[model samples]
Target: MTQPIIKLNPHLFFGGNCREAMEFYKSVFGGELVLTLYGEGPPDAHKDPKANSEEMKSKVMFAKLSGVITLLASDNPNNTEAENTGQFGLSLEGSDESIFKGYFDKLAEKGQITAPLIKQFWGDTFGMVTDLYGVNWMVNITANRD
Candidate 1:
């Protein structure tokens, strides 16, 4: 039997200030940062026009700060709605590649796969998803040994 080994990482969700937030953090820690915009995400991730507004399509879809630590973030494309989704999301890091895909498939079943799992410029297999409960999740599998 095999089960996914998951580690929690801080996932941030902003109205549209995700890049700003990551920039600020970078200033503090001075680490390598990688960012992806909403428009860069998979097509399925933009099905919700409200969450993928013209102004938001270019907003930060995912960001990672790898300096003193690893901090993950993104913009809440669904910001204008009545209920604010707040400024945070839960991130999951898996050690095993297979486990990572398994978790992603299971979680995405009843949720929205905001970012289709794919290879990122930062050399990581990553994706973003919003669970059925409206909780945002970011999953990553490191592509190389650091």
Candidate 2:
């Protein structure tokens, strides 16, 4: 009666200011906007003046393109004179939910888990984690039939 959801999609992962970059990408590749989600997380904090930067707050937390491809991002994750991770990765997705779970679990053994494999607000079974080498990885199994 129950079958694991599958995600047949592609996503792009970026360092910081992903929003601005996505907008730039939109210019390069045209696609009608479907949705843009902003993290309620207080990116703006008086503790650090950088956090209060008007321009930074407006950066992209996450953006979806063409209804299928997704752009995943965060604000540098560095508060102080932090060294830029300066690293990026490409996400791969497919339907077989179980297979992806196994893959993600194994990867997490030596890495960081950003999101656990679970139903997402966007109606998809999704999870994100970084590998031991500090590479971000996203796995999604679609819950939405569409």
Q: In TM-score terms, which candidate is top?
A: 1
lDDT of 2: 0.56
**lDDT at residue 108 of model 2 (Cα atoms):** 77
Q: Who wins the lDDT comparison?
A: 1
Mind giving the per-residue lDDT tens digits that candidate 2 earns over 10-80?
A: 45444454555456434433564443333344655346555456644654444665623444344443432
TM-scores of all models? 0.48, 0.40
Q: Please give, for residues 60-143, the per-residue lDDT of candidate 1 as tens digits.
A: 878999964578888776673323453556677766788677767766766799999999998899999875445567889887
Error of 1 at 7 (Å): 3.2
**Residue 66 alpha-carbon offset, candidate 1, angstroms:** 1.0
Clashes within 3 Å, all models in order: 0, 3
**Pairs clashing within candidate 2:** 6-142, 7-142, 19-60
